[model samples]
Target: MATTSFGAMRGLLNVKFFQTNFSAMEHRSDIKKDNKMKEFQRILKSLYENLIMLELYPRSQIDLQVFVLESDGSYKSAAFNAVSLALMNAGIAMKDYLVATTSGLINNVAVLDLIYTEEKKQNCEFVMACFSQSKNIAYLSLNCNKINAKDFKNLVEMSQGSCDQISQ
Candidate 1:
């Protein structure tokens, strides 16, 4: 779940993550201590910083609170898509629609939207976000080591196609 609010503050934006008792996969009570959660927060913040028209809200900040209800593969990409929708619903001005998706390489083949099981079996996974209209990448994360240039290109292409489909 994501809740976004525009408020008068010093920073341009702030993102926070919370996990409820129902979040079975999260063992920590304090989200700040969880490195993965902190990383996600940072990633989400960067993804929106450039897309949002911050100049319009001078001396204000956009607060985004994301709740992790479950642990699943491709959650990072899911969060980006969720926040984008929330901002749009709130009538926030943006340069373009942000679309994100996860793709992985299994047996040297590029695959899209891997479930938890498939994600573990992947040789590498790519989390990518791009503007739907411009098709310019806003963020990219590769979760593994040692993917050849050709295979990396294939995964990027596959991820872009997946993002396009999700945008549609």
Candidate 2:
């Protein structure tokens, strides 16, 4: 029997920008923005290095999966949000593409991306997968019972928005 094991790593980005009354008069906003940009760059750099290392494995093929434990609006969309940036940093070639995003139906309304609270109240949940570069859907999975065809179509459209933002 041949066994294949998958290894996973988790990364966190907790950035806090506090404003003191005294410093608010100064360049506090500018300072905070600069720090945020630096943090974003660091995250992209780390993800790129990790993906590159995964490519070094001798396996004939490898699958990279990313999960977002915390999200405000674009939960699934945020999962691989940094992946393209990382891939660009590492200079990896991809025949196809990978994109992910979350959707929820709340109060009979289909929302593109739901925060934690909205997700709690929603009756339906969906995760849409697509090609990162070509903007083609690969798969869609719905939780909290099955959804109708119309709702499914809406989910695809909303999820596509997420993919488009990431591609740019």
Highest lDDT: give the candidate number. 1
Taking all chains together, each candidate's TM-score versus the true structure is 0.82, 0.53
Off by over 4 Å in 1: 1-11, 19-33
Output the worst ten-in-a-row residue range by lDDT, candidate 2.
10-19
Tens digits of per-residue lDDT for model 2, 1-168: 222333323222222222233422223366674674465445434434333444334333333334333335443345455455445565555454466778889977888767767877898988776766667666566787767888877777877887677566
Q: How does each model score on lDDT?
A: 0.81, 0.56
Model 1 scores worst on lDDT over the 10 consecutive residues at: 1-10
Q: Model 2, stretches more than 4 Å misplaced?
A: 1-75
lDDT per residue for candidate 1 within 1-168, as digits (tens), equals: 122434333237888976555554435556544777788788778878878877677667778999968756787788889899999999988888788999998888888887777887899999999899988898899988898899989988888888888888
Instruction: Output the TM-score of candidate 1.
Output: 0.82
Could you say which candidate leads in TM-score?
1
- lDDT for position 105 in model 1: 88
